[model samples]
Target chain A: MKLLRNLFVIIFLFAVFVPFGNAEEKRVRWKLAMTWGPTLHPFVDTVENMADMVETMSGGNFVIRIDASNIHKSPFGVFDMVKLGQYEMGHTASYYWKGKDMSFLPLTTMPFGMTTPEQYAWFYYGGGMELMQKAYEKNGMLSFPGGNTGNQMGGWFRKEINSLDDLKGLKMRIPGFAGQVLAKLGVTVTNIPPGELYTSLERGTIDALEWVGPGMDINMGFHKIAPYYYTGWHEPATELQFLVNKKAYDKLPEKYKEILKVAMKTAAYDMYIQNYHMSANAWSTMKEKYPNIKVKTFPDEVLNAMKTSYNELLSKYKKENALFKEIMESKEAYLKKARDWTYISDYLYLKSMSDTE
Target chain B: MKLLRNLFVIIFLFAVFVPFGNAEEKRVRWKLAMTWGPTLHPFVDTVENMADMVETMSGGNFVIRIDASNIHKSPFGVFDMVKLGQYEMGHTASYYWKGKDMSFLPLTTMPFGMTTPEQYAWFYYGGGMELMQKAYEKNGMLSFPGGNTGNQMGGWFRKEINSLDDLKGLKMRIPGFAGQVLAKLGVTVTNIPPGELYTSLERGTIDALEWVGPGMDINMGFHKIAPYYYTGWHEPATELQFLVNKKAYDKLPEKYKEILKVAMKTAAYDMYIQNYHMSANAWSTMKEKYPNIKVKTFPDEVLNAMKTSYNELLSKYKKENALFKEIMESKEAYLKKARDWTYISDYLYLKSMSDTE
Candidate 1:
């Protein structure tokens, strides 16, 4: 009888310990959807880097398979799909969903908004993250900064814009809130599909166009055709977004969760650096090989007009939505203080060096 | 007989799986020594953040204990301690080790170096990491950027500096390579203990002093005594470093290695943002409470002289050390290209906005 009792106790211990051990070794598979196609540099690279970190950090026990727009067949559907748990997570820009929710527009960027470092400060250290959570809470999704493209170029123009008269009646391939602001300035703003942008600009179907900065823009061959590459105005610091279904996120193990969060954060910052490198290299190549690609800033008259239109549009949105109002006010207040430090620090430093030159 | 055979098989399986599971579950404890004291905000917070991320990502299997300067009793001894494996890691500035090796100087920041974003691009993307690893390989240690204080304030001054003559025979409490450059320009440079800096400046023993920016300088209460706050010229992007014992790092489990790297990267970026937030808040507080503080830039004549002095010192070091020459040339070339982008992007944006204001 004692021998039998000992056998039973041993069996119970084995049953208890064996499953616990297996749990640690269990393999978890997740799927991610990205708004960009697989061919996009830095953007696609950011998603891949995050998954790589997650896999290596989790020892292959947790894996995330990414589906780009080519596979997913719906770039704009990412937020809804993640919300519905169709995919565990997504990489896309928040402003892309403005058609569904107008308040989601400014999360990506704002005209004359905070610069990259300033926006990052606001996101992580200021109340930007909390406000973002609040914005997405009702949608059953979680959002984080996926990556940044730094300051995007204003656009490619066949002719230089030296006055407000030069902007009026201009047909430009620009999109989103910036498009609206441009349209208000009498620009015949039209959205051309990405593949058609270069052809349209070349063929004069669109007189001007705005893509990303030189890093992503070099391939479009726009610099060869349009010599006037203006500095950015509409989007100062365009940050991409990472969307995760709250239910999917909640189901993750604590270790996996931390790994995912850290991986995402690091990957976001990495993309910014990577793009900086690409832009620098591309700019160097362009400057040496294509000397005609003139870099210009919109004259003060045109810029001030654009700013006025931007403010008016922002005011309209603020009046319509309380949350939008709150978010904008927060950004304005933070920018006022942060920009002062920026002016006294980086701005002055650059100014001093340039002055000497 | 059959039941006994089955029990033997089960016992063998348990032996194999249990050890494997335990290996993954094994707890790793590491000790880190920081150059800053426990009270240093954002700097100390950066170390804690990295450790916290490591713990959570490894599910408490990897833990790091941080010892501040107060506990370690040796602020400058961190590099040696980590090298000797007395501590597995350290948080300090790279320039602190210039006494041991002059090549270690520019890794922190040059007299007029890249800004935070520009320096980060050089570090992560533009071959800086490879060069750093090569430099530190002889010491059996690895280093990474721990945090950034962004552009430090040039210094606080009791009187304005309007010309090259203003700097002549001026006693200033400044340290490191910047002080070396300043001393060359006929300024009487002195290094005072941090606790006595305020008193020294108040008693006219020091005419000017450079500490960290508004984020850290607020605590020292220097603004009350020194009315002239000059913008940064030296140490544009002062990056603190994390030093790790290589053999100890190599021995870590693959999972822990990824966790540690990702944690360090995230924490480093976080510190930059956190400091940005702190500086913004502190500057606002200072401006509101202390209306007498005047922000100034050194006159063009003085700046030009300083630049000349800086170039001479750098050239002297470059001729002495091949690696230092290689690193500085690399920085100069990269900065030339990157600064063009910066001028067109953030600089123009700020210039336009300020013009309107």
Candidate 2:
């Protein structure tokens, strides 16, 4: 009887404790590829912040290591790598995949679409996440908002753009859809590597380039060369995306999954605020250091022409792709309601203050 | 020798597994009190969302139960309850505790202050959090951003306030420091419960009342009675706060602590976006249903007077409290930087689009 009692105790301990041991000992190590290079502030910071949060929350049981474009050697190839499970996850913008899937174009931002708060509202509560998931799931990947750059600057220009004529034959490095929009306006639009951009602008290989805003643009030394810094019109509220392989994500334990999701979200929001802070600091620095740098808005003629070109490009995509049309319509419908609120809320409030000040 | 080996196995098992069992089985249950009632949409939702995330992220081991004002019977007592450790946490606005500490007034919102994004940037990246911690730590509690109401509307008014004369002798229900500002302008400022607001406005007991913007005010039925909905100046970004007992927070395990903090952050941001969505939806509904509801901004004379009154009130607070003066100076400096970025980025972008559209 004594022997039997000891045996029963052994069985109970083994049954209860073995699973706990397994849970504790199991470690998840994930590699993430990034579109940006290692030195990109706020952008690189977002990925690192998410990874750090995951490690801390999961008590180092789940770790995500990030590889920038320099290490990966293919910045634009992140989506494909994540899709094929070459990297478990990737940090890039959804709009980068427009050539592969037209529906992905407006996921990042539209020319005159919703602002940051409105876009977030649309994503979380206004059926955007469903559409985003539907678009990504077909590629065997899940996508999430990685971060927001708030509103991007229009670009750094060597000369002020006064009219549509001023844009004619101008060599500018503007990427993706915005490039296409400017392309229709008789401008020479080119895409260059980030490292070569400063030299390209300085040597007059490119007369203008639109990188991110002051937070990011300050490090590139663009302000020294391009005195005419135009305000944003192309990618207002540019949101970066995190793409994860569906199989890899599905395999995570429930606790780890929740931790990863929450971390990514918190990191995304944090990046937006951080970028805002950085931009404020950078702008203040620029003003103090480069007093001659002029901030200008495009003339009415140029802005109107760009708008027409944007609408034309959008229409062509809408006719060519059903999902593109569906997504644009969803965004357009939401933007209408959301913008009305924005106008009444933030817009008017800011205007009132500005007028008084 | 065989008996000794069996005894050794039992000891090893006990050493490894007993602590694991205790860690897995020990559940921490906490109660949170809220100043708002259970039915408040995004406010209540923020608490529920935080609790839900905590439960999920902790794998049901850490749970938070929320008590609304109806149950807690102490809308204004949340600060004391959290400080005394009577509740593990409390969800309320920091401005509610202004009587206890003058510095708490500006933490929520100030007249003609930063908007949502600007305020959040200030809070997270511009040393607002450090200042907030300094204020709350003295009370034996920790405070975090609970949610933001976006840009609140000025008020629902029955008559147009074209000048200072129109505002004078006006019976209004604008609460907090804003009410004091209006009181200085000869307005009869009254405090009415949320339930009595519509009735009070309808019967001519109050001529104007500032509630939360369209999102929250929709359910209050204020728009039907008051045709003139004015844009906000006071309480431009009304941020709610979550208060945690310092001792209770210190006792949490590392993983649980991280989970709670992240969950709170995510919930706070989510609520802002959710409220934005709600406001957009409600505004659309209100416009369609109540076409007569005119969106107005106070004239320059009234706005200028209100601004002067607000500055005077702030000057008094600054003279009385050194911490209040310090916090106000910090906010003012950050706002100067952040608003410059805001004007160049979102403001310019929105203006450009509005002009073209």
Candidate 3:
């Protein structure tokens, strides 16, 4: 009778605790590749923040190992690595994969597209995530917004661009769709590695170049060579992306999955805020030190021509690809309404403040 | 011998799994109070989202139940409820407790302050959070940005103000610091419950009233009666807040603490984006139904007088409270640099786009 009782006690304890305990502590280890080097501000910080949140939330049961481009030795290969499960995840921009699929281009940002908050509203609430998923589903990956650079400066120019003719035969380093648009306006567009960009511009090999905004640009010393800083037109609200292997993501325990998702979402927003701070501080310092640097906008004639070129290119894409058309239409419809709100809310408020000052 | 073996196996299993499993599954239940009623989205939505994320991320072991103002019967009592630990947390705006403590006012926002993205940058990356904590620490609580309403509209006015003289003796229903500013400018500022606002405006009891922007205002049908919607000068980025009892927060398990923090952060940002979407859609609908509604900015003379009045009120607060002075200085310094960036980035971008269109 005693032996039977002991057996019953042991069985009950095992049934009650062991399986549930093991499940809760189930370990998940993932490796993430990045398109950027390790030292990149805000970008690398975002990945680390996401990983740290996951580890802490999961009680150290889940860990993500991050590999920057130095270790991966393939900056642009992040998409393939994540898709093929060579890495469980990756941090990169969707626009870099435009050559692989035309639908992937607008997933980042377009020339004269919606600003950061407007784009975020579109992404999360205005049927953007669904369209984004459709773009990545064929690649066997899940993509999420990683971080946002609020706006990219049009570029650094040696001289102000006053008219469309000023762009004619101007040697510049601008990439992606904007490069194609500028090419139509007779600007000589070339792609130069970021490391050589400074020397290229200084040596008159290039007249101007579009890098990121002041936050990322100050460090590159672009302002030293190009005195005229044009405000953003191309790549407004450049959102970086996180790509996860669908199968690997599917394999996560439900709790860890939720943790990863929440962490990623928080990290992405944090990066936007972080970069905003960085840009403000950096621009302040840059302005104090380089008061001679000029801020210019492309004149109406040039701006109008660029807009026409953008519309033409967009029309071509809409005709060429159905998914591209679907995504563009969604964005255009959302942009119309969202921009109106933006105008009445923040824009008017800002304009009034400026006017009063 | 068999009995001994069974006992040994049971003992080993108990030693290995029971303690660990029990720790992982330890149930924690908490309650949160909110200043809003059940239907006041995205405020209520923010709370629900946080609770849902907490429940999911903690694997259902930790749960937070939310009680809206209707349940608690104390919308303004949330600060005290959270401070005294009647609830583990509360969702409310910081400025609601201005009568209790002057320092709590600037934590929410200021007249002519930073916009949403700019304020978010200050809160997360700049010194706003630390100062916010300093303000709450004395009350035995911790405060976090709960959500943002972006930029708010000034008010719905029956007639336009052409100059500072036009504002004199204007009967308006505008609350808080903004009301004080207007009152100083010789306006008759009154406070009325939200339910009676439309009727009061219609009955000529008040010539103007400020509610939230189009998102929260469309339901009130104010535009139908007051066709002149003024642009915002006050409460540019009205951030809601989450208050946690220090003791309750300290008592949480480390993993649960991380889960709660991450969940709150994500939910706050999500609410901001959600509201952006809501306002966009709402504004579109409002415009379609009421084509006669016009957006207007106050005349320079009127705006300049309001700014002078705002500065005077702020200076008085600074004299009365050291903490208020400290927070205001920090915000002022941050706003100076951040607004500069905003001008070059989103402001300039929006301006150029509008100009071109």
Candidate 4:
């Protein structure tokens, strides 16, 4: 009886302490490939941040390996790498795959796009994310906001684009839907990765390259060769997404998903935070580096012309793809409501300050 | 005679180019005030952010004068008057003055505290002005993130607090500092005016309070309610500053003294930005809607007993203030350094994530 009682006590203790018993029992190693190099684009910095968060939050249970930049291959390969199971997770522009489905552009960025907070509201709470994830399912991946860039400056280029005439046959490096619109206008559109952009521009390979914005471009050394800066024509409300193979993500326990979600969330905002720092530094440095590097805005005619082109591009997609049309229509409807409030909230306040006080 | 002809031609061109007649004269008018009820606080906010900025930037062509706070008899004067000052100017804490400063707190927040970036960096770069000026400041005053709000919690209480024992004292209504920390300790601190504090605590109206961390405490609110909440004790860091006296501000030429330096500048980091919206709402609604509230931190015995007390109360400050002292040695040394990096690069990057890709 004494031995049996002792055995029973031991069994109870084991049951009580089982969950906290071992450290190595639950650890999982993850390889997270990031396109952000050491210190260049804000998006890359954000990827590094997410990798760090994943390790810490999981109490070192999960470790992500970020291969910053396309050290292995190319940044555009991010989507397929994860899909083909070459990588567990990777980051890429959603619209880059617009060829898969043009509706993907809205999922990435809208021209003259949704404000950051508004996009957050639509994605997280307003059922927009659910729709996006549904769309990504076709490609064998899962998606999250990853991050929302506040807004972007136009872009930097080599020459002054004063009018419609300037855009003609311009061998511009642009991607996605905006590139499609430029193609419609008589500009020769070329899509090249950031890695090759410098040499191409220097060798007169491309007339202009519409990269992220001032900060990333400046770091890319684009200011040295392509001094003419213009805003984005292809991806405006650009959103960089992290793609995880659906099969791989499904195999993980619920806990891993939570960590990934939180890590991804952290990465999303960090991109904007990094961009804020990079942009300020770039603005100051750009002028000092090049005397003739001029910064100018596109004329109203140009802005209006692009807006009209955007309408045509979007309309064609809507006619063919029911999903693209639905998301766009819904996004527009929600924007109408939000924008109305913004007039009272943001615009008028500025106007009143400019006028009254 | 030939040299004299050349000089005459130069003089002719100078006269033609000067064009004082076509200088296109410009004028602006504005009014502002501070929250200190007609004292130097109000004067400082109005003068610096508003009147001073205008006069200096405009080269003294404009002039503005802000009436004192209580002269207008507004304890929450900035809140009511700022909308009127929208085109005018007024000043208050983003958190304290939050009934109105709610939309502005992201500029301030004490969780990690307002770094110079959020204080000035975000304000100037992050569309903070459009949000802050148009929404809160424009209620009457065009706003400026006048100063810093390093990092602070709450004040002290009379009772010997140990865990739940901390909250036994009754009637704590305060804003700014000690509210969140002590409340987490189960102490219910509330926002009480400086005038009403002495009367309330003496009449057994309250238990404890927190003012402006350590530096401003002795003179502001803590000194009066002394006997607890040790100096350099409860709140190790708390940032403060003023808003513009808009009317007095807008009337200035342009470019003058107190240009309200860059919020990220080493000096401007001393200004305040904002905190949580819940803080102000709590202040306005606490006792009137909820409990009369007793608030306090743990006793020295209990504080020492608390696991993180020393680190929370002192150690981190030792490192930061050391750096601060190296850069600035006024004892408020830590605050300057605190604002410079704590929020933006240090705390923000440490705590926040950046990318999806």
True contacts kept of each: 0.73, 0.70, 0.76, 0.00
lDDT at residue A115 of model 2 (Cα atoms): 87
Ranking by lDDT: 3, 2, 1, 4
- Against the unseen true structure, what C-alpha lDDT does each candidate score? 0.90, 0.91, 0.92, 0.53
**Candidate 3, clashing residue pairs?**
none
Q: Cα lDDT for residue B167, model 1?
A: 89
**lDDT by residue for model 3 (B1-357), tens:** 677667766776666666655666668899999999999988899999999999999889999999999999999999999989899999999999999889999999899999988899999888899999999998899999999998999999999888888888999999999999999999999999989999999999999999889989999999999999999999899999999999999988899989999999999899889999999999999999999999999988888888999999988999999999999999999999999999998888898999999
Q: What is the DockQ of candidate 4?
A: 0.01
lDDT of 4 by residue, B1-357 (tens): 556555555655554444333222234445555566554432254245444434443334345666666566664656556554442444556556533333343334433223333234344444445555554344445544554433333454555345546454445775543344445555556677677876677666787655543323333444334445422233222334345545555553232222322211212321221221112222333323334333333344444333243236334434543432221122223333323222222222211111100
TM per candidate comes to: 0.97, 0.97, 0.97, 0.52
Task: For residues A198-237, write the lDDT of model 2, one tens digit per residue.
Answer: 9999999999999999998999999999999999999988
- Could you give the DockQ of candidate 3? 0.65
Relative to the true structure, candidate 2 has a C-alpha RMSD (angstroms) of 1.9
What overall lDDT, based on C-alpha atoms, would model 1 receive against the true structure?
Answer: 0.90
Residue-by-residue lDDT tens digits, candidate 2, B1-357: 568667756776775677666544357999999998899999999999999988987777899999999999999999999999999999999998898889999999898999988899999999999999999999999999999888999989999888899877999998889999999999999999878988999999999999998998998998999999999999888899999999999988787788889999999999889999999999999999999999998887888898999899989999999999999999999999999999999998888888878
**What tens digits encode model 4's per-residue C-alpha lDDT throughout A227-274?**
765543334345688888888888765555655665576467546545
Q: Write the per-residue lDDT of candidate 1 for residues B1-357, one digit (tens) a residue.
A: 557656755775665566656657778999999999999998999999999999998888899999999999999999999999999999999999988888788889887789888889999988888888877889999999998899998989999998888889999999989999999999999999999999999999999999999999999999999999999999999999999999999998888888898899889988989999999999999999999999998888888889999999988999999888988888999899888888888898888878876
- Per-residue lDDT for B288 in model 2? 100
lDDT of 1 by residue, A36-115 (tens): 89999999999999999999998888899999999999999998899999999999999998777777877888988899
lDDT of 3: 0.92
